[model samples]
Target: MLILSLGRAGDMNRNMLMALVAIAPLCGCQTSNQADYMQIGYGPSFDVAHAQCEMQKGSVDQGYIAIGSPGFVAGAGIGNALGNLAAEDQYMKNCLILSGWKRAPHGQGAAAASAVAAGTPPTPYGIQRAPGSWINTALLDWSDANNKCVAGDKAACGTRAKLGARLRAAGVNPAPV
Candidate 1:
């Protein structure tokens, strides 16, 4: 009887050990995918790259650049550390966008409108006024117009009035003022 009891206890112990082994992963003891990415330093880089890409694509606003600047820097740092020029470029582009570097048409409209309103004087097609000024104006105008439209003011007539003084000041031609 004693031997039989000991044998039963041993079996029970083995079963318990097996059960623990099975449940170990489910008991909050395993690393999550995000955690794994963090461990490999991929999460931060990916996030920065993603943001930079979006900004370059003009899907994100310039104001958000400040927020994503650090991410871009970190991403670039990581890419450089890993000796990946492609990744570094991707991150650097994002940083530039965030730093108010205008790329293309995404921010053009706002600039035109702002130039018109600020009266900063319009640049004849080939003329230039400061490095990123045009792009900035286009972006600002686009964002303002978009916001007004979304708020049920698609006409943008009101904004035109408000920005008129600035436009006149800037010596923008064909001014209403």
Candidate 2:
């Protein structure tokens, strides 16, 4: 029997580390514009609108697998995955807009942090809901009205008051804006 032993395990470890370093940029490199969205509908809320949008398009993960297979052979699997996810995200955004869902003025950092803390899926250029947070459609209207009012639109000041009153009725204090 002939026995062969690879000499110097440290060399193997070093090579592995180098390989990881080379591919570090490829892992989880999907860039996304995280934000909050809201919709006003007595029947279909933001969640329903999101689901309907998703149903119209193929799954983002499914595209990743299909594109990633050939991309890996070409040494661009992660890049391809990012491209696929971005495309899906754009499609979803368009669909939501058509469905009457609009991006909220509020920032997403706090919501994303809360969602992450609650063990929800990380945002990856798709429809992700914030945990324990409800989308107030009046809040969105109030934000738009606030912006217009600030821009010297006198009509918007009246609209802002109407929207703010709705928020107050729901026990949500609209910030000074």
lDDT of each: 0.41, 0.57
Compared with the true structure, what per-residue lDDT tens digits does model 2 show for residues 1-177? 112224355754564465556567755553323246544222344567778877875655443222222223223433454566677778887877676555555675446535645876333322443323343446656876898899999999999998887778878889863
Candidate 1 per-residue lDDT, tens place, 80-112, comes to: 333433444455555534443323344453554
Backbone clash count for every predicted candidate, in the order shown:
17, 0
Question: Which candidate has the highest TM-score of all?
Answer: 2
The parts of candidate 1 lying over 4 Å away from their true place are 1-81, 84-139, 146-155, 174-177
Model 1, residue 47: distance off in Å is: 15
Model 2 Cα shift for residue 132 (angstroms): 36
RMSD of 2: 14.3
Candidate No. with top lDDT:
2
| lDDT for predicted candidate 1 compared with the true structure | 0.41
Give the Å shift of residue 146 in candidate 2: 24
Worst 10 residues of 2 by lDDT: 64-73
